[model samples]
Target: MTPEARKNAVRWSVFALVGAVITVSLLFGGVSDFHPTAVVRKVYDEVEALPDGSPILISSDFDPGSEAELKPMMDAVLEQCWRKNLRVIVMTICSPNSPELADSIVRASADAHGKVYGTDYAVFGYLAGGSAPILALGQDWHAVYKTDRGGTPCRDLPAMKGISKLTDFPLCLEISAVSTIDYWILAGNAKYGLKLGLGVTAVMATDYYQYLATRQVVGIIGGVSGASQYESMTRQDALRKARETKEAGDLASARMPTQSAIHVTIILLVVLGNILYFAGKRKEKASP
Candidate 1:
């Protein structure tokens, strides 16, 4: 066979393998009720134990670039919060692009849980100056969040009552795609002593585990795998609540199998390409 035929054969093999994996991914993507990781469970349980009407803060520190990885985490956490009837305040800290992203995600979750804006929840939009805003946060809620993302006076938002500073919130969940998590750790957790949990990209997980050792962080929701785990646990919790009135066990359809397959396919594709490149190099060296 000619060299061209060999190249075609290798390309077709890779394509076929990826197609097979995608098929399997779709077939098993909907699996549920599986066990969650310890890190993810700690986060779920901590929020689960909060009393109804307890207020907490969630800082979404990612952009659209990270939506696929972090949005699921945000959704699962918000579902659990609303399931327990917890009051929430949403914000975008690290990523300037996240205000609209945060707004959209929270809006959907609020609607799903029949939550009322301004009363049950509020969205504080983006502020410039990088992590400098963290220092300004607890000093004056009104000065920092004078208005909601929609330009409504925060005072009109019933949810803003009793929240003066960062410490006013007993817990703050930071879901991020960048080093914003580190900034929050230093400013939000270490400086103010506020309790911190995280939902970070898979790559960021390893770097932040050091904080977990010191208990500086409560727990972590690391990437899509961790997000799926938390969603499973949330599903179980929802099941025990009243079926019609309470939150349903229906977490968003699982993304685990498909996400995993896509990740694996990408790795395999890179490896196959490298192998074929080397094989071709050897063939060229051997040719007359």
Candidate 2:
């Protein structure tokens, strides 16, 4: 076969192997003895420890661009919250389109868990004006979020009960792919003392360790890999849905094998390409 065709065959074979790994990982959960990160476990433990009927806020501050990474985290955490019977108030502050993107996931989880709207959960939707709105949440949530996404008055919704300001909620997790977490850290955690946790894209995750160390962030779950770890802990401690497609942890863990496989494949292909190029040049020099 031509060198090009032979290389193509090898590449396709690697891809097929990756596909097999993904299938097996999805069928059975990822890498055995997958140790859950301490930070992720901390978040899971904190959520599990909350009182059955207490409220928590989840702010999804990313648009569709971050859906792959943040959606699984959101799903896993929401499932945990639902299992614990904690009230959830979800909102977004980054993109105008972020609210609807997150709402579908929330609704799906609510449906899966038999959670009711206005009672068990509420979507405050997107709040504009950047950090100002977040600061307003600190001052008076009722003032800023006068109503939920459905236009029902905030005062009328059971979800908002006992939540006068941002600090009233014991924990607020900011899931973002943007700088919105900075605003939450400043306005919500630093100023109002809202107990904060975070979920961020992989690249953005390292930036928040200082916040975690300072206790500004209760814990931080970063990217799909982090979601995979969080999923493990959730399954072991709070709830376990064995191979359940709808369960976020299972869904997230399924993606990890695929991601790791693809990454390894790319690195191998790059190395192979360089080796082939250098070998070809050596052959040419020897012959000519």
Task: At residue 207, give the lDDT of candidate 2.
Answer: 94
Q: Which pairs clash in the backbone of model 2?
A: none
Q: What TM-score, over all chains together, does every model reach?
A: 0.82, 0.82
User: Could you give candidate 1's per-residue lDDT for residues 13-100 as a string of tens digits?
Assistant: 8788878887876654554345787888888878987888889999999999988888878888988898888889998777667889
Off by over 4 Å in 2: 1-33, 235-250, 273-288
| Best of the candidates, lDDT | 2
**Residue range with the least summed lDDT across 10 consecutive positions in model 2:** 237-246
Q: Model 2 scores what on Cα lDDT? A: 0.83
Global CA lDDT of candidate 1, please?
0.81
